[model samples]
Target: MEQTETPPPGRRVALAVLGLSAMTIMANATVASSLPGLKRHFADVAGIDTLAGLIVTLPSLAVVITAGLMGWLADRMDRQKLLAFVALCYGLGGTSGLWAESLNAILAGRLLLGVGVAGTMTLGMTWSADLWQGAARARFLGLQGAAISVAGIVFMLTGGALAGLHWRGAFAVYALILPVAVLALLALAPYSRERRRAAPVAKGMARQAGFPWAAFAFVGSLGFVFQAAFYITPTRLPFRLEELGVANPLAVGALMAALVAVSAPVSLAYGRIRRHVSAMSVFGLSFALIGAGFVAHALAQDWHGVLAGSVIAGLGMGLSMPNYTTWFLARVPMAMRGRASGLLTTAFFLGQFASPLVSAPLVAHLGLAGAFGAVGGTLIGLGLLLAVAQIWWPEQARPETAPAAVS
Candidate 1:
């Protein structure tokens, strides 16, 4: 009997995978600039201020709620097909605001959009794990982070432009994903089926070792903290700009885009940074940068001051995603990748959902600028603590080797 080798994932497949990666960021970013518009449109509703923030974060809450199931499905189903289906859902759910007649209707749409995000985001990470390993995987994850940052800039700008026209116009940006769904089906379905047949040993090994709950909890906590602090950009920055007397949605979007723009170069450099630095140390540095950026925001007297803070915070954003993702993926077994990705998505977005909840009270007491100051101070302290721990207990911060490749 002769055995055939599975073909490598081609460039088309890589392109498809990268495109899907962008969707995870797009899940909420496309509408962030629209929040002010949404609030104005629905001003008559009860609790418009808080509810407006929810519009930006509702998908995150949805992702938190649905990610576990998405993870379970990722392990059980044909990943390519599932990705296609979910991409379609992203388009439909994301665009719902375009015609949604009331605030409640738009909220319902955002909930559905979150469900789609859970599946797409989980699958993107799972597929990346499936297709690459070791340094190559690290490099690719860095590139993925870079690509996501670029997408954030585009989505933020587009959403802002649409919001300028009307708050509902931004929802049309989601319709673009429908084509990406087609590309995923065409590019990935056949390759994935063949790979699954070739990787039975990996599945069995994963089954035997079981899920790493402790490691996941540690990594997930990192994700949660990073996102909670970082999400302040998308959730709070627009309002901060408003207070600065910048009212145009396009200008708001551009400033928000600037926040993401600075992250791209840093993300592109992450693979090299990992070679010299432990993941824990990398995280510490990222926290410090983000903290400093936020403090800058709190101190901003004008739009230029806010922009400077955004650029600084963006650098931290660039470093954090690849580190958290690479740290966890290196430790997990093949069969458990989907569940692992699911856990990551849940933790990250759960933080996003919590940001407003945690910060709103502070805002009431301290004012918006004061809230930024408080969060910034806490993050800076946490970063220092992490750096100290890494130095004193070096073993805790040592980078882990990825599991040997399954040939």
Candidate 2:
């Protein structure tokens, strides 16, 4: 593996790139918050509730279908350029709802937004892995998680606020991606071209590196579980809050923000945590926190208890995401980084897409509180099982060390 002699971009530039990456997650956050507004606007449409719900979830479906193709493209093309193009599409497709005359048209726009998000997110992680390594890589991955958490808070609040005016106002947030596309062009374009020219490894070398099937399966599995659990907050928490007699939308937004707020600081400290604990231990702890948070949510009789539960759950949410990314990056060859990242993205969003399906039945059968209890108990059991596995088969829990040169 030949290292580039050219200095990496400044921290500001790196942050700018990562900031754009954050926008990918915000696609669903704001739109999910605006679902009620959309539902009302399209109330005359048959299956209007389901149709409006798809506006929030359809992008995940797109990502699952297209992320692999986007990842393949990233490996062969100029990633920075691809990022800019996708960002432009993200803005256009995301805001398409504002002008769309019909529910079907809005759904079409969401599908397009999904395409843009797939490319942007897969490429963003691939680019980050390319630019950083070792402890810095861990820290940057943490920052990526932190950035997404912060963006979720901001976007969710903005969506809730805008939903008060009109669902169209919520779509306005998508236009912010246009400026991010410009930033990608200005800050990353030259560097990407430089790296391509300076690279010494042959294309055949990358091809011969071979995919890490076991590692991919392991990470993808974990990604699915983590995402499904984390999504319970966004998909179900608001309604739970409403059931508990906290019906103000802003208060619901505030509580949701609390769930993610702790994630930012916790994610920022992931490097430090990684230094002391094994990856398996980190996963176990993250699951434990999530389980504990959900149990609190199950038991809570008031809003303050919900806030406490969110804070604890947020800690788990923060740790689980970065830990998975760090674990994946550590094992995969650089040549396969994009493809592997795409698979991970697919697994994650597939979980996001499935969360409601898996949990909805439970909600109906058990009621919201019982549903929380069931999920909490399951997560705690998983945490305990993983912890025991770590003790019994520590070697298996650790990431595999890849060859020095991917070729």
Candidate 3:
């Protein structure tokens, strides 16, 4: 058979993928925002309280298991076809949350949702890398990060709006978007079922082994702060406000939404930013803001303090988040992008997975103020650690030489 010339993903294809991922971000926001509402439906089910939160978390757990496989498959198969098929899980999983009366069904749906997230999240970067190399690819990937952050803001607010109507209404929106994703993907974009690459040889594996792994760990640690702050904050914020005599859940949601809204533009700014600053500087600044903000929140004992922390953290994440994936890829061979995506995403979500485990213990021992300070302290410590590495380890701080694309 004759081989066809590699066709790049046009802006339309990128937009469609962004649409699919925006829903994933929304699904994430829904579970975070709507957990209290889910309890009522779970009342008759056994183990409700302990289990309901897992529904929100199981997707990240799934990311750890599946992200690498999905990333590898993206590099080895027809990525667009894989994208369209996996997107169904995202829609279906959200729909289950809207409809499921029993706890078991919801858990099952959450697992499926994780599968969808793994596919989209990994492909978003690797697919872009496949389409464009160097600076252009970097900008496009930054745009994708911006899209997800904006969706975080949109879905957070949307979930809050629907909370008054009923929590199920928030998830029901996923059903509407899924079909639109299907149409946009199938009709507007062109991807064949076959991929164009020879298999990875032993030398390919050796090149992959030499990748910059520390950046993966450092950036992944920061991801925990991103998803955790948004996910857990929304869950607890209303109660925190209510305890302090604030009655409006909508207002609390709005506050979370506003902070989350900052992430997108900040993410977009990375494209311009990578031109001037080193990725290490971006990481240091973002985490420093986040860590300092948390300390500020601990000190304020008021909502203004909380908002200040959120704003600072949001600005920091926007700068740092997009660059990590690009920076991670920059240090690796192209053929390994899938494996790299998977490994990097796993680190990212694993941080998400650790959020409650780490935060809940602190809150139990120290109270919310202590908990914020504790989390903030950890962030600050990590920031300092990264700064040290950048200062001492010039390789991570400087631009990378192009390694061979995995053949």
TM-score of each prediction: 0.88, 0.92, 0.84
Please list all clashing residue pairs in model 1, or write none if there are none: none
- Candidate 1 vs candidate 2: which has greater TM-score? 2
Give the alpha carbon lDDT tens digit for every residue of 135-192 in model 3. Answer: 5555766787788877777666666677658867776766755665665557444443
- After superposition, which runs of candidate 3 have C-alpha atoms over 4 Å from their true positions? 1-9, 32-37, 98-101, 176-232, 235-244, 395-407
lDDT of 1 by residue, 113-198 (tens): 89898998898888887776656666778889999989877776787789889988899998878777788878888767876785
The residue-by-residue lDDT of candidate 2 on 1-407, one tens digit each, is 33332355687668766877798877687876578777887889999977877888888898899998888877777777778778877877899878989988888888889989988888778777777765566677788889998887778678767877887888988888877777777877776776687445635565566677787787788789888877888778888998899999778888878878999999998877776677788888899899999999999999998999999999998888888777776666676777877888899989999999889999999999999999998999888988997798663322222223241
Worst 10 residues of 3 by lDDT: 396-405
Displacement of the residue 94 alpha carbon in candidate 3, Å: 2.1
**If both were scored by lDDT, which would come out higher, candidate 1 or candidate 2?**
1
Quote the lDDT for 268 in model 2: 90
lDDT of 2 at 92: 77
For candidate 3, list the clashing residue pairs, or say none: 335-406
Ranking by lDDT: 1, 2, 3
